[model samples]
Target: MGDVLRRRRPSRAVAPLRRDPRASGRFQRSHRRLDLRQGCVGRRAALLRWALAEMQRAFLGVDCGTQSTKVVLRDPATAAVIAVGRAPHELIERDDGTREQDPAWWIDALRGAVRDAVRGERFDIGGIGVAGQQHGLVCLDRGDRPVRAAKLWNDTTTARECADLTRKLGGDRRVLELTGNLLLPGYTAPKIAWLASHEPEAYARTVRMCLPHDYLNLWLTGEFLTEAGDASGTAYFDVRARRWCEAVLAAIDATRDWTRALPRLAPPLSVVGMLRREAAESLGLEAGIPVSAGGGDNMCAAIGCDLVVEGPAAVSLGTSGTVFAYRAEPAVDPLGEAAAFCDSTGGWLPLAATLNCTSATEWVRELFAMDHAEVDAAMASGGAAGLAFLPYLSGERTPNRPEAAGVFVGVRPSHGRDAIVRAVVEGVTFGLAYALDALRRAGVAPTEVTLIGGGSASDAWAQLCADVFDLPVARPAIVEAAASGAARQAQWAVEQTRPSLAPVTSRRFEPRPRRDLREAADRMAALREMAGANRL
Candidate 1:
């Protein structure tokens, strides 16, 4: 873990520390009183040091993602990334449709990422924020330790529980009215319902239930609190009102008292608490640094891309693909295809998520024993070649088919490996296009699209997204939007002002009209219908 952190160092040196013009006025006014006190030479020196440190402080942002924990250190004023580090954690997958991770692994990964990010650097950290994968259920007992493995968002063992909750709530539409979302197997409420029915002993022992980011926040600040963005994904939260809905909780058999199990709600940009002594010591940082109430990964990514204002939508193509847009008012989809979520900036986020993305491309790359560059070359030359594929390697979410499996249609012997790989890539892009259409149906019309996540690193993939979505796609200079957004939240918490740094677009891909894509779209529609009819 330590080795993971030490592997990457910033290519450029940070600018020398200087007095911040923004803080000079306040510092001068406060210093006048320090000089007037009698026998205060030591106190004056300490105060001066503290004031100077504040002028040159750097902010730390930790992103506890599904595969790894990433840390980024940046200048709050300029938003220039000074250093970065990451550490990977293992994911437990089961044949019985279970996905779980130990909370302890997250803590260890965060420690490594922080240690590596700040190695040989001595800038005072002004504030810290964390963003994590949403919808994960972290259960704690009276001792504040996890009673069982944390259930992740991809875990699908709660299908029966989802059906039961929907029935108890009267129907899917009624559930959507109460919670702004339909009962889904990936949601926290269904997971809790499953736990109560299957593992009654653990449910009885549970004293608290929180998301992954909330657990990390508790370790840092010793306060159990969550903000609107992540809380809205819990399925028990009322998105329109921005609070927990007792009716939704009752539907899951968690009564009014279950609200106590949830963390206190905090404003997204507010400081939840100062870093605790133990956490500071473990990460080699000073105690009392302000920690902001961070948000879910999607919310933070929106911030990282400067999607606080409308007109630009963000499409993240990671293990899962999501299309999200900022909205001034809650945009509830009556059919429940789009999730009505809250943004970290006190706005609404209407998003549609698909279960598969780069995971499909990765599968093809591994099958051919090729590196990314090799795959890119093959895709550039192979084209679609009339081959079609459904990239539902791990089932699906947007179309609501949990039992569906991957399918390859229109394949011929002459198509070979390269053509199949290209088909896989196109299939994933088509899946994202379906999500984009859902957002459009919900009345989100973005002037431009921001493509992000691990897949955005490939120019070929970015072009494919632009061509398929039929919109100009821009990739920001910084690829780690989630961590960058978390840092911006930290800056906002410490300064009491929104960070003014605009995301710099390093490259933009314009949509190109292709006759072949039109035919491919038809094939995709037909294939989707076939899969729906033959769902396993």
Candidate 2:
């Protein structure tokens, strides 16, 4: 499996994600085509586009995350965030590892959030982009309406389906060769298989299966389309070749031609379609506005943080945590531990994900009846010694254990809510640290990591990331990196030029000298091993 990508490991050529097209234009001379940042005229022309972007049109980005739909409006030329609004989601969480949400909820949330962001001012909207949590299975009928609630990325109910698919496809090595990654229960292909097995009636009625963001695009433009970045997570995409894996589709259903129902793979920085009049009215935007080929949340965050040229890795501490680094070439984890995904900027994103992060913290907060302030205080109270947290509230992902649940180890009699919360934070950080080690083995070496997502809002958590990853951690001033990345992608699709954007960071946290949590990391690893093996 490693040999497939090892042949191309040592060389990569692509320009970095740009803050100023004048300084550096997005360039790629690789064998891969569809470079979003190709035709650059000159500094004067680029600067003129920048000025026009700010003055002529307002770009919109909609991010439908696990817990909310956040809308961000930006002046593309100036890269200044104009307005932001958010609306919460009601997840259908079950003890049986079932995580779902009604597809209608996303559009309704988008409607509310977009209306809030625009504040009914009706600015000249140029383009819109969508960044959504990936690997969700959204089944649709012949009329392009959802057949059932969308299964989310954190859902772990499809372990049996994942195993059956792998087994039928000649096991792990062959599966990896087909998909460029292992079949995790969190992925969409497994969910589709599960739907066929468990809900045969719904599956029979389902004429198509689209990802969460793809579904949003369908509602907006009445077209079925997906991009390489988000498609890579579906377990039916050839990440290396940037196409659909026919073998995986056959394994899912030999009877049906699943590829026919799959959305067209749109190129990066290209408009998937224009906004329909109904969607425009609902979103309070102008009709016929272009919609960019937006990507998965992590992919969008990579652009938002400017991680295109592989300077440093990115740690997105969202509902589920992810540690990823942008690579010019494919970053293949030979052991199949990390994901070999595609980036939004026509590059590769080698990534490792944990199923829990803020989800774990929020659970602990509710368990202890504490507010966000108290959670921050608990993060600051890290005096608890010999304690470890194993965050598996939504089951494990990187370790590929779907049945495991979260647990607190080494709790002493003196351990209070504050101490427990501290351990929880530490445990979540340790999980991401484990992922970072996997990336390191995959050749993703970096001196620092950029922080994004809701977890980055806490000062104590930023320090914890620096301490855990043992690298300098910086949080960009752009609070909603995914949404901002979406808007920026939309801007690029409209103008076909890189926006002059830079990371506006408020602070950078440096790891303390020899903070030394090796023992704790090992302890958590041991607990994870035991818990995953059902021994803890």
Q: lDDT per prediction?
A: 0.85, 0.84
lDDT of 1 at 277: 87
Q: Least lDDT summed over 10 consecutive residues: which range in candidate 1?
A: 8-17
1-536: candidate 2 lDDT, tens digit per residue: 12321232221111122344444233333211232333444444455445445443578888999889999888876787888988788899889999999998888888777767766454567789999999999998989889999999988899999899999999999988887799999988999899999999999999988999999999999888899999999999999999999989988898997667899999988998988888765555657878999999899988888888877999988888999999998777887889999999899999999998898888889999999998998778664477788888778998788888778788889877788888888888888998998898778998798998888999999998998788999888885899998998998888999855777888999987533377787788799779866896
lDDT by residue for model 1 (398-505), tens: 877666778998878789888988999999999989888777777788888999999999998899888889999999998478988998898898899985688789
C-alpha displacement of 343 in model 2, angstroms? 0.8
The best candidate in terms of lDDT: 1
Clash pairs, model 2 backbone: 19-501
**Candidates in order: C-alpha RMSD to true structure:** 5.0, 12.2
Question: What's the residue-level lDDT of 293 in candidate 2?
Answer: 92
